[model samples]
Target: MIAEPHLPAELATLLPPSLHALCVTRRHDQGDRLFATGARPAHMFFISEGEVVLERASPHGAATVLQRARRGFVGEASLQAARYHCDARVLAASRITRVPVIAMRTALASDAAFAMRWVAMLNAEVRRLRLQCERLTLHRVQDRVLHLLDTEGERGRYPVPAGLKSLAGELGVTHEALYRALAALEKTGRLERQEGALLRVAL
Candidate 1:
């Protein structure tokens, strides 16, 4: 069932009144498929809780994850598409807001303040995707882990190693591969797993 959305007070205040009025907040369970490839763009979403992965299957039948969005907008780039080009999967129980495409377009065209916010959100998404591309260029699992830590951490470390499998998923690798990499790093005294989703780099 779609429940009322829970957005940060500041974000709630920033949403243009018209767009905000049309937004539908709801709860989506894990494994829900919000949209599929080639579907008409119906709504733009914001994740208030949990995660969603934007993935597309390759010609070879392997899934290539384009984005694993935890917060903010998920399909900002597809709001204008006649049909969605990828699958939107919910990876965990989540709160989300779905703003119909027509409402989004209206706000972007008629509301200057909302237009600026939308542009800024799109720019941020681009920067994140670029970083992911750069991370994907590395051949080694350890390199990928370090790259994620470097880009996503605050001072060279994540506080916990709790989500190793999820980490592997984000890196487009299997759970076993991430486990092996973490084990190897531990053997080399390079990384240590700690409590509370913490993974520390041993210096």
Candidate 2:
């Protein structure tokens, strides 16, 4: 069995006491398989650090990533499903909290306040996924980058949460294409990178 790891204490703030008490932290190396498609959904993983991608097979037999998470709950929808429809793969060395699905359901059933918070979190996750889907549909790399700034940023600026290569992947473009897009944007004064990985966009 893979060994569990210690999670950061700050995560306690996001979860209710009932749910937090039931979470067990675990460590996963890069490329670890956290769960497989059609597996019984016995647990929900909350990512504390690093990254994980949730993917499913497309009709063309290629893997299509449905979600990418660096922090927050990775499988919030698993609570409503008996089995997972997508595979969860760790993209970087990670610390994740595993919460027993049964216990989580019981908490939702027993605690009205916690249930509302859980529903709110799920709604926010859906909003984020919708934005990601829209970003992936744009054909141009610069359009994707600009859309990210508009949707994910404030005041025409967005912080780079991960490496540029990873961001390119999330934007559904090759790293080289994304690099060219960034360069073009910089040259056109449409975007600029500041010292702290902060990207400024001219809307």
Candidate 3:
């Protein structure tokens, strides 16, 4: 028999051990729709590998990516929601662990330490959202790009193992626009595109 995939250590440590036994892990292909807007929340999904995105479409048909989760929970707000407010789709081939909503709720209600850890996790997500909001408010695409590197990237370098185009959706810009901005930055010697990453060049 094949062994079940376990939760990522960062998340596994936060959830109660009892909940770990209830997790169901599976592999998903890119473009798989995990859940749709208006669907009743059945489970909380944790991305163990690859990317999953939460998105919502406007009346004009433009989709806004609310979250691009590579190694963390997706749509965590759905735990208390009656229905999903946005669609959850796999942005890249992924391994995911699903915890039944009811089981998760019960664990939180019964496990104070686990609940506190969960709250702290959510707070960190909130800060990321705030940073994203700030990035979106910047008028220049290059400014947004630099802001992402400065904040989300490690040591001023952002991994682009999937290439920079993969970031267009999260950055709320067309791939063409992002490419142009990156090229302009490269011309000015402010950015360096290396294999699998973009580095900020110090003046």
Candidate 4:
């Protein structure tokens, strides 16, 4: 059996001793296998390191990445419903802390702080999804790219971390189309190409 890793001091305090000692494994997954799939309320995860890509599959077997979870982000919906509504896959080598569904519910029922924190986390997820929907519905490709840079860029200067191909995939368009859109943005003063990352709309 694996020894449980230390949780953030704040989080650890909220959990009962029964849960604090629970083991969390580090894993790397390729392609699509169910780490958590559909609305099943059985488990919850706290990502300690690396990234997890959350996506929903279409009826035709197409998967669209909804968001990428970095370190410290918690993936909890899995343990709430009957099944997971989306799929979670490790984008790189990842360290994750797992908590059994029953433990989570018991904590929520007993610890006010834990319940509040969980509710806050859920609210944030909802807001993020709403923003994504707004971007997909109202923003043009150029606007989306600009917005992404504005939101993700560090300081006023940062290289475009993701390539046009990846950007296109996220935006649900062809790479050529994204390139054309980027070109248009480049022609204007909205975007500037640096050595690697493209600087956008100065911080």
| Candidate that scores best on lDDT | 3
Better of 2 and 4 by TM-score: 2
Tens digits of per-residue lDDT for model 4, 1-203: 23344675545655666677763554544342325554455566666544567888878999878766653444565555666777777665555666778877777899887778777767876776676666777457887777666664565444432345555666677898778887898777778777546677652
> With candidate 3 superimposed using the best TM-score fit, by how many Å does residue 188's alpha carbon deviate from the native?
4.3
State the displacement of the C-alpha of residue 114, model 2, in Å, after optimal TM-score superposition.
Answer: 0.7
lDDT per residue (tens digit) for residues 82-175 in model 3 = 9999999886768888889988888889989988998898899889889999999998999999999898887888875345677887788989
Error at 55, model 1, angstroms: 3.0
lDDT of each candidate versus the true structure: 0.76, 0.80, 0.84, 0.64
Compute the lDDT of residue 143 as modeled in candidate 2: 90
Residue runs of model 2 more than 4 Å from their true location after superposition: 1-11, 58-61, 137-139, 153-165, 188-198, 201-203
The regions of model 3 sitting more than 4 angstroms off are: 1-4, 57-64, 160-163, 194-196, 201-203
Error of 3 at 106 (Å): 0.7
Clash totals, every prediction: 9, 0, 0, 14
lDDT of 2 at 111: 85
lDDT (10s digit) by residue, model 2, range 1-203: 25554446655655667676667887788888888999999898888777888999999999998778876888777888988999999877787888889888898899888778777877887798899898888888899998888887668766544468777778888899988999999998888887424365554
The TM-scores, one per candidate, come to 0.78, 0.77, 0.83, 0.65
**TM-score result, candidate 1:** 0.78
Quote the positional error of residue 202 for candidate 4 in Å: 1.9
